[model samples]
Target: MLDSNKDIVLDELNKVFDTIDNSQVDQMVEMICGAKKVFFVGVGRVLLMLQAWEKRLNHLGIDAYYVGEINEPAITFDDILIVGSGSGESIFPLSIIKLAKKYGAQTIHIGSNSESSMKPYEDLFVRIPCQTKLYLKDEIHSDQIMSSLFEQSLLLLGDMVAMKIVQKKDIKDLHLLWKKHANLE
Candidate 1:
C-alpha cells in the first residue's frame, strides 16, 4: 500500500510538471540570475518550500532572503521578489507583492491561478496548474489532499532552477558549492 501510494503521488507530480510552461520557467531562471538579490514571500507550507529554495539559492552563492527574516535587506529596483501562493489570492503575499512593486522591484508570482488578484502586481506569472482551494477550471486534479501537490512541485521547481543556474554559469566543479554551505552546521 505504501509503494502504491508513492506511485500515485509521483504520477500526480509528473502530470503537474508536464503541464507547466517551459518558457515561464526560462524567464524565471533569467530573472533570478539577473537580479542583484532575490527575496521570497509566501505563507504556510508554501513559505516553508520557499525557505528551502532560499537556502538552496544561498548554497549556489546567490544572495537570497525570505521577506520576514530578521536580517533581510531592503528590496530595490535591482532585486526581484519571488512569491509562492498556490491560490494567488493569499492576502499577505498579495499585499507584499504590491509593496515590492511599489519599491520598483521586479515581481514574479508562482501560483495556480493566472487570473488571480496577484496578476496586476506581478511582472511575471508562473502557473503550477495544479488543484487549488478555489478549484478553478482546468486545474489538474490531485489525489493528495489540499495543496500538497502544488507545494511539492514548487520545491522541485526551485531545484530545477538551481540546476539550470549551475549549467548556465558552467560551474565545472559541483564540489565548489560547498564553499557557500553553512559552516556551523
Candidate 2:
C-alpha cells in the first residue's frame, strides 16, 4: 500500500513537470520585465504561491502587488495578472479576469485543467494537470491533494523564474530580495 502511494505521488510530480510550458514561462518573464505593474491572485493554496511571486518580483525591481491587499490599485492595460486556481472556473478569478481584460490588462493563469473557464479568458495559461479537488472518506474541507501538489510546483516554478531574471538582468545581489521582505512589528 505504501509503495502504491509513493508511485502515485511520483507520477503526479512527473505529470506536473511534463505539463510545464517553457515558452509560456519565458513569455511571463518577458511580460513581467516589460509591464508597468504586476498583480497576482489565487483563492487558497495557490494564493500563497502568488504572494511569494509578488515578493520576488518586487525584489527584482518590478512594481508588484497582490490583489485584495490594502492600497493595491486596479490592474490596468500596462499591467499583468498572475492567478492560480485549480478549476479556473472560480467566480472570483473569472470576474476579475474579465474586468482586468476590459481595461486591457494581460492575464497569466495557472490551473489544473487546460479547458477551464479562465483558459479562454487568459492571455496565457499554465496548465497543471491533476485532480484539483480531493476529499477524504469523511472530510468536509476540500482535500485539494492536487492543488497542493500544483502549489509546490508553482513555488519551484516561481523561484526558477526569479533566478532566470536575476541571471538575465544581472541582479546578483541577494540583498535586493531581502530588502523586499516585509518588516512588520
Candidate 3:
C-alpha cells in the first residue's frame, strides 16, 4: 500500500468507530461492574484479547476468569459471562455460552452481526460494526483483512470499559495494579 493511502484506510476505521453503539459500551461496563464473577470465552486472537481484558479486570480488583483456564470455576446466578466471536458461529464458544446460560449466568455477546445465533443466548448483545469472514462480501466492509477490524475494535472497547470501571471505583494508584500482578517470577 502507498503512504498516501494510509490516511484513507485510517479514516475508514474511524468511520466505524464513530458509529459504534455507545449504549452497548455502557451496558458492557455496567455488566462487568455488577457481575460477581466474570468469565470470558473466544477463539484465536479474540481469545488472546479477552485474556488481556481478564488481567485488566483483575488489576481493577474484579474477579475475572478466563474460561478453559485451569483456575476457572463454575458460573452461577450472580456471575456474568462475556464472549467475543467475530463470526459469532464458533462451536466452542457457542457451547460455552449454552453452558453458562444453563448455570444462570448473565451473558454478553460482542460480534458483528445482531442476527447471530449467539444473540438468543446472551442477555445483552454488543454489535460491533466491522466485517468478519462470514460477511466480507456484504455491504459493510473493512480495509483490514479478515477479522482485524472487529478484533481491533474489541480490544479498544474492552479497554474503554475497564477505564470507566476504574474511574467509577476511583482506583487511582498504579501500585495497586502492580500488587495484583503475578508474584512468582
Backbone clashes per model, in order?
0, 0, 0
Candidate 3 local Cα displacement, residue 171, angstroms: 1.8
* Candidate 2 error regions (>4 Å): 1-11, 134-146, 183-185
Off by over 4 Å in 3: 1-9, 136-140, 183-185
* Model 1 CA lDDT for position 103: 96
TM value for model 2 = 0.82
Which residue window of length 10 is worst by lDDT in model 3?
Answer: 136-145
What is the lDDT of every predicted structure here? 0.94, 0.77, 0.85
User: For residues 67-154, what per-residue lDDT tens digits would candidate 1 score against the true structure?
Assistant: 9999999999999999999889999999999999999999999999989999999889999999999998889899898999999999
* Candidates 1 and 2, the one with greater lDDT: 1
> Residues 1-185, candidate 3, lDDT per residue (tens digit)?
57756775677668777877888888888888998999999999999889989998988889999898998888999999999997779999999999999999999998877777798898998877678877744424876667877787778788888888988788878677888888998
Residue 129 in candidate 3, Cα distance off native in Å: 1.2
Pick the TM-score winner: 1
Best by lDDT: 1
Q: Considering summed lDDT, which 10 consecutive residues are worst modelled in model 2?
A: 134-143
Q: Could you tell me the TM-score of candidate 3?
A: 0.90
